[model samples]
Target: MTDVMRCEAVADIATPIGHAGRVSSPVAEFDPKRVRRLRRYTWWSVVPMASFYAILVITGLVNGFADGTYAAADLLVLGLVLLVLTVEATRFCASTMRGLGQGRHHGAEQAAAFIAALLTAGCVLATKPEYGFIWVLLPAILAASIVTNATVSLRWPLTFATCGSTAFVVATASWRYGPPMVPIRFALIAAAVVAFTIFVLVVAVWFWDVVLELDRARSVSAELAIAQERLRFAAELHDVQGHHLQAIALKGELAERLVGADDGAARAQAAEVAELARTALRDTREIVHGYRRSDLATELDNAREILEAAGIATTVSGHARSVAPPLQPLFGALVREGATNVLRHSRALHCEMSILTDEHGSEVVLRNDGVYASDGTSGSGIDGLRERFATLGGQVRAEHRDGWFELVGRAEEPGRSEA
Candidate 1:
């Protein structure tokens, strides 16, 4: 939001008197729709880990119930431990997915981990001797998941220590309380479960991180493009005005020196200075005019590049020259504004621009498939286009129909006689 506001403020300062009321720069607004879509993607990526964790919790509870050797007190203790692990796991996952700068709730996470570990020890002590290390699987898996959420510098070492300790505890408990043959096998199984759980949790966190990085990169790329455009305009203005201003300055000095000494020479130099000034003024106007005039073919090509960069497929049809020359600029503005809307306003997957012309009039239609909803308001850019087209006996309209958002503009052929 600060970046956008800064750009808008600069634009306001730079705008000419005639353009003061024009629509704001397309890049000046942040796209909440795109942000929300990315957020949804982030949440969905975390679902697999969450679902697997839930399934394991349920399985543990069911297994304890089926093992009838456990008394009511033991079962109650196991349930409470599972509940604490579940709450901690939830906190860890939330903190990891929210990314950096948001609070990680380290105190709560530490408390949960401590409580879970203590409860696991209780379960280990209370379970029947024959059951051995079976009750430890749930807490072991939960602990590994929580540990993997550690900062990058400590994640792997912490995970390894957690896994090794879990295995050793399970092995010792089995040897001390279970059938003699089960210790080594149960230890290996415990290690495998913890390793696999950590792997899944790690992959899910990595996926979420990648999505966030991509989003940040996209924003940086847009801001860079805006900066480059400003530089280009500045360079062109400097190029156009620099030579003329220099020559005018030299001529004015000559005219000043010649005065009272050579009246005729002074008048000639003054005329030259005036001519240079007029030429500079004219050239500056031309440069500004060319800058403001949008060309249909150039805009179409640009739109294709931008949409493709954003992962949206783009198709542009119909020749630029086929549109009446007078209407080309209008259609070009439509294309540019349409592209901006498609990107910022919708989760568009595909975009199509079609230019159509005949003896009667010219038309350009932009279509995109990601229309979620439309409240029938076309926004300031489209509203401005509508007013411009209306002055020329043409019309521009935005419509949402048949799962597509369409911006259509039509204008009569210039110089065509009325019947």
Candidate 2:
């Protein structure tokens, strides 16, 4: 629930109601109750405006009565007109809310709201002969809604234009009525226009900043993933290649010692050396191929060959066929990294490779029983392997205890083995 609340808040802030004329909110934050509340508030906007109209009617009645010209029939008619305008305003707000929440026809709702406000203003102006001061209520309510919403979409533009036109009409009507402060009223209208323009510019800048921030975040995430992949690749190369070279060097020295005493023995040892060299070449090619990162099965085969050439027994078991292609490289990378670690660090007589696949994707494990050095430092190989797996949204763990070492890598989904 807390996560949901946070997501809603982010969505509400990010979604822009720009010049597209659509009332688009962040889909993430949309809830039926929120829509209902918007509708309630929109309709509730009519209350203050209607109250002003009531005051106008009451004042008119009081003025007429003071001059002995007031009639109960005239007051009743004025009250009825106010009631009709209030209902229209309520309907317009309700429709706007429905459009906003349902992702329906927003443009139509905005048009309706504009039209209603304009008609109400025009009505007030037309009736100013009977209730002279009543005309002020329309522009006051328009300005209030504009300030309260803080929104500058199509509706706002329409609002600004409507209010400006209403001001022009009011000013003209006042001049005709010989009002003493007509010029002051025109000056206030000019100020409202300037303020609304400034509001529009501010909203545009805010929207641009939001888009830029989102792009920056995505770029940072991508860079981090690439860095992790590079590390894992380095670790894998160190582990696999390091052990193979060490064994070849050791075998060459042994062959040199037996060469002079017995020709046959010397030749046999030479053959072993030759075989080891061939195996090493094959393993190196496979590792390079892993830089391209082939399927899981291919990597498994290479791992087995590398282990066996190092005189370490290896066993692989489980269904190897159903793994998805996208995940193949990740699995292969895991196998390559694991085998390299075993050869360089484990010194185990036997190593086991097992793969299991079910509904959850796939799992690969490598374990060996060998002499694991207790030195509490990992070489560049292990560090590189860790970084690689992390890029693919996977993890690697190395454990050593009782002369056994285990390296495990698992990925949520397969990715390219090469960084």
> By TM-score, who's the top model here?
1
> Which residue runs does candidate 2 get wrong by more than 4 Å?
1-4, 8-76, 95-130, 138-153, 179-419
lDDT of 1 by residue, 1-419 (tens): 01112322443223221121333333332343555566676656553354455566556556656877656776687667657665666556666676532326474555457446635743463455444344454555455555545667667776677677667766776575557667777767777777777776667667656556656555455444445545666777798799999999999999999999999999999999999999999978655533344567766766665555455667888888898777766777778678778867888877889988887888999999888676756698888789878877899989887889899999997668474
lDDT of 2 at 195: 49
Q: How many residue pairs clash in each candidate?
A: 0, 8
* Global Cα lDDT for candidate 1: 0.65
Q: lDDT score, residue 77, model 2? A: 64
Give the total clashing residue pairs for model 1.
Answer: 0
Model 2, residue pairs in steric clash: 228-387, 231-384, 232-384, 232-385, 232-388, 235-381, 235-384, 327-414
Candidate 2 lDDT over residue span 268-354, tens digit each: 777877887787778776555464435676666645644543445678987556666666766676776677667556646678888
lDDT of 2 at 373: 62
Candidate 1 TM-score, C-alpha based: 0.72
